[model samples]
Target: MTESVMPTYGRLDVAFTRGEGVWLYDEQGEAYLDALSGIAVCNLGHCHPAVSRAIAEQAQILMHTSNVYQVPLQSLLATKLTELSGMSQAFFCNSGAEANETAIKIARKYGHSKGIDKPVIIVMDGSFHGRTMATLTATGNPKVHAGFEPLVPGFVRVPYNDIDALRMAVSHWPEAVAVMLEPVQGEGGVKVPAAEYLDEVRTLCTQRKLLMMLDEVQTGIGRTGEWFAFQHAENSLPDVLMLAKGLGNGMPIGACLISGAAVDLLEPGNHGSTFGGNPLACRAALAVINTIETNSLLAHVTLMNQQIVAAFEHALSGAEGVQFRSKGFMFGIELPIACTELVKQALAKKVLINVTADKVVRLLPPLIMSADEANKMVNIVSELVLAFLATQPKASVA
Candidate 1:
């Protein structure tokens, strides 16, 4: 009941007892509309029946086995992932950080195979990769790196969505072997690059003979209304793609997919995970994919995204100093002032939303969220924002 038990998360007073579809219930029976969806980890909604059944069945059958033995579910899931992502091979892990670590190793090995002694990778500013040692070094925010000094080397930081800066960094760091980035910067305030930016990146990677790795941990699955966010663009696929978050709905699973020449970089013994591709996680991923396909959730995601974006724009377009930026379900409502306190107000009103980068109200709702649910979310947050803005001083309105 105190700080001695767990690290601080600045958590709200209420604790959720259960969740279904787009709603969560507190112990006292208060209902909260879940717009964050566990930070995009519940694309199919919490405890989806098919996914739940698969987990339950697999838990009874075989939950885990080491990487030493054959894992058929792992192989099956890999095949499905390759079909969905158009990648040549996959390396399964247990978290976004592990998937990214695999990506980092792949890039370095690819560089070494190409006869480069010291390989470097270009990461973007305002980007969030993961919290592990190597991934923290790859991350662009200094706040994640403040105490973790002597960060890993071989990483060159550049501004996001700036092709010129990327080119300059590649030229400056001759040992650079790859460019790693999130297709949509989720944790960094839901930032989306220009539509042509990914195309340019793909072209540059091809020309420079570098691996174009996309950290789709937050943008993959049906979150962006596509199998992968890059697929939204015409012929802009990456050589390497990292995935996690909603891949297994709530199950812990992460994967690094490789294609073109990068596929052969990781030999059998190069990397592995004890519980990465275990039967339980693989079955959950398979069920998640099947449910998405069967219910046409991808199309639903696109439709719901359009509806929600339009509604948010209509509601907040001329509301003093409010603005919205979105693509599919990943959205950020930017308020003129820092609205960190609004999280508490929204919770009091029984709505679950998150504020990121201080001023951006970031939302990554479940893909199956309906128009009614979306409206409820918009109305609750819109009222809260308008009320909060009205309380600010006139001089601060600017």
Candidate 2:
């Protein structure tokens, strides 16, 4: 209610007081099916018992200590991340933006170590990196850069899934150090590239001697029914992987993973964070990972993803004015007409969803969502889309 609190986000009217599993309760106790899951942050579902217990226990012991000393939990988390990702090392940070910033620094440092000045990174169109100055400049959407002037240099943009364009850019700019992208473009309307696009990109990066960096901020930690979306594709493992969103299951921890030649770019005193890799955050992340493994949430995610996709296809596919694109729990349904208003309509029906790129209805439910909850989500949104389409003018039908 105060203008001084920074008016960056378009605030929703409802205020959630508590969340459990796949449901959120507002102040007045109205229950809404949480399909967005805080934009894919609560992958294990809200208030997970294991995560809550870990945070409580950790809070009683240690909360914050500067990264100037040895932290056992941090080391343990790094080891777990490396073993899972096949990367050599990890640098912990606070958010996706900071992780991306670290990745940028690593790429440039890798190039500088090779005696190259002014390194450039190849980014993809419709990709959402983050909101920091450098990461915002790296983002493909121009709207995010509207007020930010003098954007950071050293980024080359190319169309998503277009290998020829990448080749031309590489040929034109020999100083390019890395190619950064999202396995599934989350904020860019859940766009999934061609299955072979990542494989081709990996080959191109290898041939050109560039780092393959993946911004898995939204697609990692079982959001895509795998530890990382790159695992879903063949030979698409990245040299550098940026992780954040669900790493701590809403506790705000991030990491940048480096492998091969890019691992040793950051030496002692080169880069550090005051609050990064703190004991409490690492403990929280450890709990999230442990819970996912102990409960087999990855398999649950895969099963629920299949059920949700099948339900969507059964209800909306060929329903005269609907189309869908999805991978695992991440999905986007494109109505025949712009459905920006459907967000409010779905909320009115006690369902929560988001609209991105104007026409795509995006749904990113928790990985623990059951078959019943998944079908409810599909039915609610499908009915909203169908009802919305009926009101469109016939002349506007494409």
Candidate 3:
């Protein structure tokens, strides 16, 4: 904890020196089971050999050359992503925020193309987009907007998972250009919408001609048992699809993929990124995609999800004021009371976990996690949760 770095984050009193598949080692070389996976950035786990080797080889040969020059790796990466996502084109950047910023620009420009002077993108309440000014404004949490006043305009929000509210908002706003949201609201407490919600949204967007944009930064790249979360819905394809987190498997890269209405919205001068889709980053991303496909981790995630969910259900069946929900490796076990302290508690027990939206203990373990690791995580979390509940009054627990 040095004063040299900005104290923007309320960081825990621990630092890791290195990490492996699903484990991180501190200064003392103590191994800790990693369930968070760097907040879903390391879907293939830390320092995956394939991604690491690709990065190393590319760094040795050619790390970067301006986007002005044709980068073959970028084209290859885009081809693989398009093949997997059914999207037409991709614009790459450095993180999830930039990818989303690209989507917002496309929405506004798309609106302009349709003769709407001011475009509005429909966002959802309780959603977490990013920390950039525009993304923070797009985010649904007021805490994210407390100090950033006079927030970016032309964005409206409705309750998540409420299709009727979305319809009303869209109908009310004549200048609406697109609808942006996560398939599973990850930072919004792992809230999974109704099974057919995406299908319904696709229908509405098609009927209204609104560009359906999905911010799949957290739920994409096989985290949701599919290449992309939107793929879970039948015949549902987004006009704009944003991705980052797991795409590079730890390498910093973000992408905005376009299809249908969103294609060609941003012409040559509309937008660009300096380091976006560089040789090194794109190579790493390609390796990540290849590794995932080769390992068959998507199906593995489905199996492990079922296993982990059943294990928790059986373990906490008798517990009151507890709720468990999951989609793939994204697990949320919510308790009645706020348990933010459980992060340090789990850390003390040599495990990593995260808490979001106050009471929802979020677990995003590496997709490469084995059954033993999964069981270990569930046991530690369940024991800690039950113990925390025991200290509270039975009435308070609920």
- By TM-score, the best candidate is 3
Query: What is the lDDT of every predicted structure here?
Result: 0.91, 0.90, 0.94
Residue 339 Cα positional deviation in candidate 1, in Å, after optimal superposition = 1.3
Clashing pairs in 2: none
Per-residue lDDT tens digits of candidate 1, residues 1-398? 47686863666788788888888999988888889989989999888999999999999999998899989999999999999989988889999999999999999999999899999999999999999999999999999999989999899999999999998888888898999999889988899999889999999899999999999999999899998999998878899999999998989999999999688788788998888989999999999999999999989988888888888888787677777889889999888889899888998898889999888999888998988889999988888888888899967878
The TM-score, computed over Cα atoms with residue i paired to residue i, of candidate 1 is 0.98
lDDT of 1 at 263: 82
How many Å off is the CA of 381 in candidate 2?
Answer: 0.8
Candidate 3 weakest ten by summed lDDT: 389-398
**What's the TM-score of each model vs. the native?**
0.98, 0.98, 0.99
List the candidate 3 regions with Cα displacement exceeding 4 Å. none
lDDT of 3 by residue, 4-81 (tens): 999999999999999999999999999999999999999988899988988999999999999899999999999999
In terms of lDDT, model 3 sits at 0.94
Alpha carbon RMSD to native, model 1: 1.2
